[model samples]
Target: MKKKKYNTLWLSFLGVTAIPVLAIFIITMVVARNEFYEMRAIYGPNFIPATRESILMILIFVAGLILVANSLWMIWMKGMVIKPLRDIEAAAKRIAKGDLEFTIVTQRTDEIGELCRDFEEMRRQLKASQDARIYTEQQQKMFISNICHDLKTPITSIQGYVEGIMDGVATTPEMHSKYLKTIHNKANEMNLLINELTMYNKLDMDHVPYDFKEVNLKKYIDDCAEDLEDELATRGVNFGYRYNCADDVTVKVDPVQFSKVIHNLIGNSVKYMDKEDKRIDLRVKDYGNSVMLEIEDNGMGISEKDLPRICDRFYRGDSSRGKTKGSGIGLSIVKKIVGDHGGQISATSKVGLGTTMHVILKKSAGGKNG
Candidate 1:
């Protein structure tokens, strides 16, 4: 389309320029014919005055031709080149003044049109970058605010517990022990928050170290589930495990970091459990090239709106916030760890039904059994 328009523009300019030149040619021919006949009739093939008149007529005709040509050239240039350039200049000025909304419209197929298209693309990219920067700034501010509040909650608790112990309020040994334990728990929470912050910083900086190893998936998850079984049982939650893989099924992973992933998911499930038949199920399945680990729970599920952002740093679901305590970076850390191990994680849930967390890891080349 633009190519056709460009060709058409050149053709039109040629046509416009030809019309005046053709008119001037006809006028000069008529003047020369009249001068020839007038000189012959008036002076009988005269030499001096007739020659003077003819010279004057020729000069006038040349001047008129020059004037017409100049006028037409100016008109053509203004329409084809100057106006578009002026538009571009004006748009540029507006952009310099921080007005990104200005648009440059052109119908030329020449260099100027290409320039306009490039300028538009640049403006769009700038706008997108500005928007992303603003969003990131807003998110950072919100994170800082939430971190301060989260830290304050535990710090305030620790301070209160310490004050109680110092004031002789816990005169009994049991009371003293309880207060000290509370203080310890609060301190632990603060430490966990700080640790999560540090881990997130490392992840952001691409500096989190991993020690990858090939391990049997069945035994690995079994051990993890077994470690949590006692705790779940003590809390009256039925725990179940299913390993639907061959005996030799294995995956390469950083065991410690991967274990953190499992722990965080199970901890989240336990924290949100509100069912009469409280249950946590751990399942492992072997795909041809990968293994899947799923931890599901009969807990208060996440809303559809909140499910997508659950793994984002410091994003706490409204339902989970009131019933449980968390540093809000656990799932984010889990996601980062899974990603670093060349795996993926996702969650599926329906409100009031249950939530299932899935982790998919590539199978190790050496599928050695435990």
Candidate 2:
């Protein structure tokens, strides 16, 4: 038979309780039985009967003592060892079954208590990791859903326009031009969405392909503003530019990606422009160690609730930004571009008024002032 772990302790205790009592009974029996006649010769004939009764009493006492010792050991083992192990075993089984919600507790200041604490810590970390995984999964699904929604609109329009053209619905030359133009625009929109998604994914993975060079802040802003002016003018929206920075101050940035940053910011502003006379102001200011570029607009502003999360990826849940159907990664792309250049982007806005986007970049020490 396989002896339990506590049996060793029980046997050790039996050495003191049962063994000694048994030894005493054996010794008493031998001495009483062997020394009977000698003691009777010394004392009286009645000693034999009395000695027999004393032996019976010793046997009873030893048996009772052994029984009591076994009983006490059983109770001690149940309370101190067996019950605690059973509790831990049950908890382990629950956790093995993927039930991380249960808790393990220990009041003793022993090794078992330390073991329980470690188990609890492991459970907590497991729960946290599971939650993070679930959140990532949800975000991925939302990304796919949002991308499909944005792509379907332009795709559907392109398909309809192509069908119209095939059916000869545009009978006149002007109608033909208009139908082809609409198809071209829809295709362009789809292309832009695809490009934004690709860029956002790259930025998210920190796989930036930048060509950093030191350029004069003043000159760069001026040239960029000129381009922005011409572009926005095409849409009948005015563009304003100002430079309040030192002429010699320079900053390192990837010109192409930085241009995208400007465009994205301006694009977001244009998306919400609601006034009859829409205008976007681009301003650059010197701040000793760094320079700040601000893009302000006279468009319908972002709500306070939306402003904080406007730059989050796939964040089209806002009331204002949702007014236009987009991939919702515009601000995310802008934020990533600015961050990659060791800069920060922020915004300030009021409902029904306008919004200003501020980007801060560290100034390069010395460069040719263009």
TM-score of each: 0.75, 0.70
Tens digit of lDDT per residue, candidate 1, span 162-243?
8898898999999999999998888888898798799888987889788888887778887888898987899999999998
Which ten-residue region of model 1 has the weakest summed lDDT? 1-10
Deviating ranges (above 4 Å) for candidate 1: 1-43, 46-124, 321-324, 368-370
Give the count of colliding residue pairs in each prediction: 0, 0
Tens-digit per-residue lDDT, 249-332, candidate 2: 889999889999999999988988889999899998876688889999998898888889778777764664346777668898
- Give the winner by TM-score: 1
Task: Estimate every model's Cα lDDT from 0 to 1.
Answer: 0.82, 0.84
Error of 1 at 262 (Å): 0.7
Candidate 2: where is the Cα deviation over 4 Å? 1-128, 205-207, 320-322, 367-370
